[model samples]
Target: MNDPQFNPETDLNFDPDGVPTEPAPAPEPTPPLPEAPHPVATGRVNTGRFEPVRQLYQRICSEVSKVYVGQEELVLSTLVALFSGGHVLIESVPGLGKTLFVRTLGKTLGTKFGRIQFTADLMPSDITGAPIFNMKTQEFTFRPGPVFTQILLADEINRSPAKTHAALLEIMQERRVTVERTTHQLEPPFLVMATQNPIESEGTYNLPEAQLDRFMFKVMVEYPTAMEEVRVLKEHSGQVAVEQRLEDEVATVTGPEQIMKAIQLCSQVLVADELFDYINNIVRQTRSWPQFHIGASPRAGIALVQGARTLAAFNGRDYAIPDDVGEIVLPALRHRVVLTAEAEVEGHQVDEALRNMIRTVEVPRM
Candidate 1:
């Protein structure tokens, strides 16, 4: 007990200077800074921003009515293709407003549009452009072709040979044209509304399967109804001045910026896991089906998701639903799937097969 003179209590109180010292106080926590605005939020329409898009759609319908008398469904599908950032193939007879539809869409959207009239002698370089040698620099400067525009009207695409069609397919898939080893990216919101005369197969090279797969939709334009025919006559039967007056009355509804914004908003629409599984099952069934030689490619699946999102946005929905997938299934997969000879001989149409598949496949519940 006497040796415990070097006691624990005394030792605990002593410091290096023989004095007690307290512990340093803890530092105060720093608050976090506010976050910046999201990149996706820049041009997108929240809840209240969709009225302008609906109004724009209405104005487009009205303007297109001036030139195109009937075929409201055709007009809507064309707009769907445009809004989805996809290419369209119009299969119809001549004098069915195919050219008019493309031109009117270009005007309505206020985007740079160009028409490439396909012919037997048309070359790939003509549509994709060629490099020219500059006299001053002695360098071959790359020049862009008509496919560089926001809206490209490939009139009678099948009329051209397979080699010429390949050039367009390349552009549609890659969105970048290569000239003299230099690659140039096409502007955003690019859409190709192509038309082919179904009545004329003579001397026309049929589009290869690879080329057809690039298009998102193969729309068939049929004859107008009797009442619609009368409307067409009344609208266009007058003198050229009257038609010009009617055309002049049509105004621009939306611009390229608005279209880009809409496309951005469309991408923001959510697709759940169940819907993705549904898409996977549909695409897999195409491969395993005995009725077809070729199946839908990976690109087809991408188109399905993108097209559904676009339809969802058009319907003013913030999230994608099963109905959106059903709505776009035909257009997204029709051109991608190649039917066998037996299926064709059996008089089975692609649309019918697609509809049957859609009906058989169960939609997942939310």
Candidate 2:
């Protein structure tokens, strides 16, 4: 080998001269971390297949807010039930916009709206039409009742007797009416929103367990905040009536077909195997929880799953998250479970007990 060159300016490739330092190996590149799905409200998650659902939700809320000043959760619960193809039983004082909300919902949905003011005298035949003998035809003709509408408001439902209440059980569950052994099927996207007063017990009958079970959610309406009440006053102080305002301000966003399509999307929302366990765990936990005497039936679990799916879609997700289930569990199981006399005596509300029980259930990462 030749003598090593040591000149300052000499190329380093020669002997003794740095042989390029073996081309100093580059440090191994770090692999990228997998991306996580963020909270849906943050606008980080891709809307993907459920974008329409989210958009529809926003539009309806926007239009509804113009007239109905507050009670956001009430609106959301109704929407959840609506998308899940289930009924809602609301408990609120009068003049809190329950009727106004339902009317606005029916307007935005572009569906027919009907209201039945339940009284002690209200009969089954009054809600479900009975066959009337026609003199012209010389035969009986079946006349459909208010129940035939796509969106029905059963106002003050508890005022009606059990027999009248029984009429709704079949209509709610089957979306049809059977009169004279002839079945008349209701159109698609039928929604029944029944409201009862918690303050009135003298004239109100307690809802049967079976009837209560039919409702996917039992929403309790709270008084609006000061700002909300001010807005309500400002909006309603005008000479225009609520119906006039709803007609002038609220715009129709969709029809029954679109609503049915959204319902289908909610039905297709992805649920992990673990999520099934999580929901089962929650529902089953309610059965044995020390606070509850009567737990939710299997229908409650079904309602939870369906409600969660609809909520997930509302958040612009095609797949449900545990948080979605958490938000939905309250309304889904609150009415289904019964607190024990001890717990009730302890001044415990069924809602509070349900939330506490849910915290004990393990959440799935999915």
Candidate 3:
């Protein structure tokens, strides 16, 4: 009623006593968007990219042969487990190059490697990091252990007590260690290659079935052939001579980033739905079978698939075939399944059961 025509912009004014109000500052100018990450370009030819992975494998084998003489199968299986992002359990007698193979592989790949010589009195905190008091910050800081590396060689893993073995299960499964109410994530491409001496069981504690199941492959390294043994002797004639020989011959074949890229490519390998169903059927049969006291866990199924993918890549293929699944059957499932008392008494091996299961399962036609 005071003003019939309202013109707020022009008529409204601040009195001397009235509160002064400033016009809202112009909205800040919007910033430019960040550029997208560069995309890797594919070539015109689809000449299998897995060729690089195969080359890397061959390089690893060659490097390992520099230190280890025989057990080509063991080396290949260990590489397959690594490609699958899984750990391995090498069960063999002493002086079988199990430790050397792991160490050499670490050298060839140019990855951070650590070895933990397990003893009967080893503690859990010895493997997983432990918290320590810090005087500077007046707080406890986690001191990482040997497990925080690209490749961890658990030498004589069975010599450790059950509790020590159990400590690694969580690290292998979750890829993290919890200390002082804080969890530390392990670096990518983390792998644990654990070796156990089969002949010396006097003081060693048998790895619990639960701990055994964490390993993707249980490789049995046997004595080399006469020819391979000859090669070993020729290569290691004398400590000084062998040291001189490897001075300039060895070189890093691949980096951690390339290895990770190859692993990601393995995930892209095609697996038909029928093949998946076949795998499921085989896993289900293990559960229903009467010969087994405990069937393979879900982890076994995953291991089977991952192992097959790596095998396919090893064969320079971009797709998984039935033969791939059949090839890795024993190593992936042997440690996971437990036999019944009768099966054990009858000397029925898990490998034999796995072979039978593979034969019973139908192969999906491409």
Candidate 4:
């Protein structure tokens, strides 16, 4: 996949099945953006591919902001997860526009959106679908569930029981659901945007740590600031319903093919070896940290690396820097790490602990 964005301005060509038919021409070299920590170690490669990827990233950010008045980090992490082949778990109070944010992204990306409201009574069959009998044929047939869609909104995922949660584990990691020994593969560019209210637990089930680990990032969405809240109210007030507003404001700017190609391109973004050691040392310290009881797993280390690579691509660089790793470390490992009871009693937060821990790890000059 030529650089993931498939730039609208450029006229590079590709086969119908997404194979590059001709090599994209390298554009004239432009001076690199000024560096804060250090210069990018390697000169840019595949500039043709990286341009479109950057363009698409900017366009999505521009379009999604039209209707969703949430944090830039929420949008950033969501796109990072989308292009990195990862899932996101969003924690926020109800009515803070969590569903609206996901729906706006689905519309802007031009991908099919499936929403499953997870309730205590929701069964496993309801999520992954179940076998149905065809009366005329007198045979059973499989019907796929909401998990089969391109962008799935798992609303209030913590509301469902563990049995229901087990259904998602296989699909999240393997990207397929098995029923009666038959596996159904999901189409490409599939993402699960699961939401939960952190303050409510009366009738909710806590997500198992393993299930939490499956998510690439655990984003915490906060209430819009006073001015931002005013802007949302001003821009959204209308006699037309919310769906109609979405139709008019948020246009389909990209699709699944482009997204998958971007994912392929993200895998190509370079990570320096020192950065690899940088990532490893951070994860290892989490285990021995005085504040954390349970440290991150190896998967957390992988997430950090992948997220850094993808974020680097979004920034139009073919090579990743230490800033890229710093940007992803907190959200990437927040849910994966657990705080000790003493630390929790001392009013320590996971994010704070991670920030302090990473400071102890040496940052690479590159």
Error of 4 at 201 (Å): 1.8
Top TM-score: which candidate number?
Answer: 4
Best by lDDT: 4
Please, what are the lDDT tens digits per residue for candidate 2 over residues 1-366?
A: 111221112211212321222222222333321322554543344435564566677778888887888898888888998899999999989989777887888887888999999999999999999998999989999989989898889999999999998999999999999998999999989888899998979978888999999999998988899999999888888888777887888887777776776687678777767778999999999999999999989998898889888887776566776777877788888899999999988899988898899889988765
lDDT for each residue of candidate 1 in 219-330, tens digit (9 for 90 to 100): 7888998998888888777776633643586556667766766565566666778878988888888886777678898878877888777766555444566777776677
Model 4, runs deviating above 4 Å: 1-32, 36-48
The TM-score that candidate 1 achieves is 0.80
Model 2, global lDDT? 0.80
RMSD to native for every prediction? 19.7, 17.5, 18.7, 3.5
Q: What is the lDDT of residue 344 in candidate 1?
A: 99
Model 4 score (lDDT): 0.83
* lDDT for position 96 in model 2: 90
Choose 1 or 2, whichever is better by lDDT: 2
Comparing candidate 2 with candidate 3, which one achieves the higher lDDT? 2
User: In model 4, what lDDT does residue 297 have?
Assistant: 98
Arrange candidates, best lDDT first. Answer: 4, 2, 3, 1
Candidate 3 lDDT, 162-216, residue by residue in tens: 8898889889999998887789999979988888887788889989988888899
